[model samples]
Target: MVTTGHWIDSSWKLQKRVLSFVHIPPPRRGVEISDAIFKCLKEWGIENKIFTISVDNASNNDVAIRLLKDTFSMSKNLVCAGKLFHVRCCAHILNLMVQDGLSQIVDITDNIRESIEFVNRSDGRLLLFADIFKKVFPRFRDREPHYDCCPSEEDWVKVVKVCNILETFWATTQIISGSDYPTSNLFLQEIKRVKLVLDNGVNDEDDFIRAMVRKMKTKFDKHWGECNLLMAVAAILDPRQKMKAVEFYFPQLFPSNEAQENISKVTTVLFEFYDEYVAANDHDH
Candidate 1:
C-alpha cells in the first residue's frame, strides 16, 4: 500500500509527496492501516498539517478512515471537523461504473474474446481462412450450440460504439490519476465531458446499448451525485477558474434545482476554510 500527500507549498504552488509506500501484511485491519499512516505522518512531522485523505471506495478503506479520524481529532482539530476528510478516488469510481455497464454486454464481449482467441491461433491460418471462412461459417454454426459463441457483424458495431463512449473516460482517467501535475483544476471540465458523453448515449437506438448506458449512468449518479468539496475548492482557488468554473459545471453535474444550491454550499465551505486558516495564522502570531 502507498500513501501520497498533496498540499500547497509556501510559494503558493501545489506539491505532491509520497509519504510512505509499504508492504502491508495479511489480515490488514483498520487499526493496522491507521498505525502505518500515523507512523509516516509522525516521521514527516506533518501529522497535524494533514487536511484530507483520498482513497478508493473499499470497505477496508472506509474502516481505516474512521480509525484515522478518531485518532487525529484527539490531537489536531481537522478542517470542517473532518467531515470531508475521506475522499473517494474518482478513477476507482469510474472503473466501477465501467464494470457495471460492461456486465450488460457480456454476450458481445464473450463473442469478441473468442474471435480474438481464434485469430490468435495462427495469424497465417487466419489470413488463409478469411476468404473461405465466411462461406463455411453459416453451415458450421448450424451444428454448434448457442453456448459456444461467435462474433457477428452487429457485435463488432456494438464494440465500436462502446469504445467511443469509453474514449473520453480513458482520457479523463489518465489526467486525474496522475500526481505529477495539478489535477484538481481539471476536475470540473473532465466531469463535464463524461456527463455529456453519457447523456448522448442514453438515447442510443439499440436496446442493449441503451441498457448499458443506463447502467453506467446509475453508477455515475451514485458515486458523483455530490460534487467533491475539496476538488471544487481547488478549482475555485485556480486563477483560470475561480467561482465561474463551479457555476458553469454545476448545472451539468447536478439537477437544475440543485445546481445553485450546491454552488452555495461550495462557496460557504470555501469561506469557512479561509476563516479557519485566518484563525490559525492569528494564533501563531
Candidate 2:
C-alpha cells in the first residue's frame, strides 16, 4: 500500500519527502514495481537529482535498488549520485529484537494469540476487559485497546520497551481476571517469560526488563550516526524541534551494526579528506 510519509530537513523541520509511492501487485514480479518507480522518477527528473535511494534488503527491494542504480547513472549536477543506497529503519531493528526475543520460545506466540482470542470471542468478556482496562489505563479510555492480531502498521509499533509491554500485559491480566477467565494466570506467566527472554537472550540486565531496554538502546545508539532516519521520524511524530542533525543524516542509516559503523567511519574520513582536498585545490589556484 502506498501510504504517505514525510521527511525532515537540516533545521529539524518536517517537510514532505516522498514524491511517489508504489506497491507491487499480488503474485509480485521483481521488475514491475521497480520499473514503475524508475519510470516515475525518470519522468519527474527525481532520478537525476537523487543522491541516494533508501530501501530494504528484502529480495525484491534489493532487486529494485540495484535496478534503480543501474537505470539511473550519476548526473553531473547530483552529489554522490553513484553513492551507496542505505537500507534501514530503526523500527525495523526494534522489530528484530522483539522477534528474536519471542523466537526463543514457540509457545509465547501461540499464547499471545490465545489471550487475544479468548477476550475477542465473547462480547461480554471483551466489554468487561475494556471496562477493566479503563480502570487500569484511563488514558486509553478514548478508544478500546483491541489487541492487534497481527500488527501491520507502516512502522510496526516498536514494543521494545519491556516496561510498557509488561504494563500492557498486566492490564490485560486485570481484565482477564475480572472476566473470571481460567487462562488469565497462564497468560500472565507467559508474559513474564517473554520479558525474561528479552532480558537474558537479548541482553544482560540486573532487571530483565531494564536490561532488554538498555541493550536495545545500546544497539540503537551504535548506529545513531546513520539510523538517524528513525530518530527523525520519531521526532516528527513527537513534533520535537531537536534531532535536526538526525534528519540530515536520515538517508544514510542502515540496519546492520557493522555496516553502519563502517559507513559512519568512512563518512567521517571522507568529509575530512574533502576539506583537505578543497584547501589544497584553492592553494593550487
Candidate 3:
C-alpha cells in the first residue's frame, strides 16, 4: 500500500492518507518496488515534492531508494538532491536492538510465549488455566481471571526486570511513530534516553540484566553509534531545544573530544540549508 502524508504548518498536524496500492505479483525486486512508489507519487501529482521515505531495515530497501534517487535526478522538477530521500525507520531499528537483548533470555520468553499460545488456542485449556489462576490468587475471585503458564520465582523476577527495561524503548517507539505530531525533533532526546537506560542496565546488580544489556548495547552501538544529520538538524531547529539539545546530548553521544567538532558540523549544515531555503523564497518572490 502507498500512503502520502504531509505536515500542516498552521495547525502543526500530520495528515496521512492512502494514495494507492499497486500490486506486483511474486519476486518483488527493488526496482519494481521503486517503480510502484514513483507511479503512486506521479498519480498524486507530488513526484517532485518528495523529501524522505521511511523504510524498515531491509537490504532491498537500500536498492529501492537508489533506484528512486536515479529517477528523481532525471526529473526537471526535482526540488532537492536525492541523497537525503531515504529515512531508516526508527521504530524498526529500536525493535532490532530490543530483540537482541531478548535473545539473551530466549528460553524464558519462549516458554512464556508457548504457554500463552496454548491457553489461547483451546477453550478447554483456557478455562482450566483460569480456574488455577483464581485458586492461586483469590483476591479477585469475582473478576475474570487472566492466565499464563507459571514460571519459577527466579525466572519470573528476571522476566519482570527485562520487561521494565524494554518498556522505555517501547514507549519511545510509540511516541516517535505518532501520526498526529512532528517526530523528527524528538529523535535525539528519545535516543539519548535509550542509551542512558542501557548504560545503567549494564551496571545492574543482576547478572542476567547486565549480560542482556551488554548484548543490547552492542546492537545499539552498531545502529546508532553515529548521529544522523537529519535528526541533528531537526533537534537544532526546534525552538524549545535549539543548540542546547545538541550541546547537552552530543557529549554523551560521542567521545568528549569529538563532541564539539560534531556540533560545529551540524551548525554548518543547518546554515547551508537555511541559505538554500532563503534563496528559493527570494526567487519565488
Candidate 4:
C-alpha cells in the first residue's frame, strides 16, 4: 500500500513524494486500510495537515474514508470541518466510465483491432498498406476472403463517434494526472470539458453512441452525481476562473434543477473554508 503526498511548497512549486509504501497484512478491510493511512500520516507528523484523501472507487475505500473521517473529526481544527476529506480518484473514475462505454462496443473494437493486426503483422502486409487507412480498408475488405472480421462502414462511424467522445476524457486525464505540473488548479475546466462531451454524446442521433453514453453517464453520476465541491473550490481558487467558472459551467454540468443548487453548495463550501482559514490565521496571530 503506497501513500503518496503531493503539495505546493513554500516556494510555490509543486512537490510530490512517496510518503509510505508499506505492506498491509491479509484481511485488508476498511479498518486495516484506515489504520495504515493514519499510522503513515502520524509517522510523517502531517496527519492534521491533510486536506483530502484520493482513492479509487471501492466499497472498502469508501468505508476506509468514513472511518478516517470519524477519526479526523476528533480534530476540532479540521478545515471546512473535513467536508472535503474524501476525494474519488478522477483518473480511476474515468477509467471505470470509459471501460463501461467501451464494453458496449466490444464487437466493433475487436473487429477493428483484428483488422489492424492483420495488416500490420508483417512486412508483406505493410507493403500493401495505402497512404490512407480508409483507402486501404475497402481493398482489404474485398481481397481477403478470410477477413470476415473487417468492420463495416457503419461500424467505423460508431468508432469515430466513440473517439470524439473520448477525446475530452483523454485530455482531462492527461491534464489532471500530469507529473510535471500542478493539476488541482486545472481540474475545474477539464472536468467541465468532459461533462460537455458526455452531454453532447448522450444526445447523439446515433443509437449506438447514445446507448454507450447513457451507460457512461450513469457511471459518471454514480461517482460524481453530487458535485465534488473540491473541483468547484479549485475553480474558485484559480485566479483565471474563480466563481465565474462554476457559474458559467454549472448550468451545463448538471441537470437544470440541480445546477443552481450545486452552485450554491460550492459557494457555501468555499466561504466555510475561508472562514476556517480566517479563524485559524487569527488564532495563529
**TM-score for each prediction?**
0.85, 0.46, 0.85, 0.87
User: Model 4 residue 238 lDDT?
Assistant: 85
Candidate 3 C-alpha lDDT tens digits along 178-218: 87678999999999999999999999999989999998899
Top TM-score: which candidate number?
4
lDDT of candidate 4 at residue 29, scale 0 to 100: 96
Q: Kindly indicate the candidate among 1 and 2 with the higher lDDT.
A: 1
Off by over 4 Å in 2: 1-13, 21-23, 26-29, 74-78, 123-269, 272-285
lDDT of 2 by residue, 13-66 (tens): 655545666666775555776787767767665565554554533567667767
Candidate 1 error regions (>4 Å): 8-17, 122-149
Residues 133-152, model 1: lDDT tens digits? 65444433454343245666
User: Among these predicted structures, which one has the highest lDDT?
Assistant: 4
- The TM-score that candidate 1 achieves is 0.85
Give the higher-TM-score candidate: 3 or 4. 4
**lDDT of residue 157 for candidate 1:** 80
In terms of lDDT, the poorest run of 10 residues in model 3 is: 135-144
Better model by lDDT, 1 or 3?
1
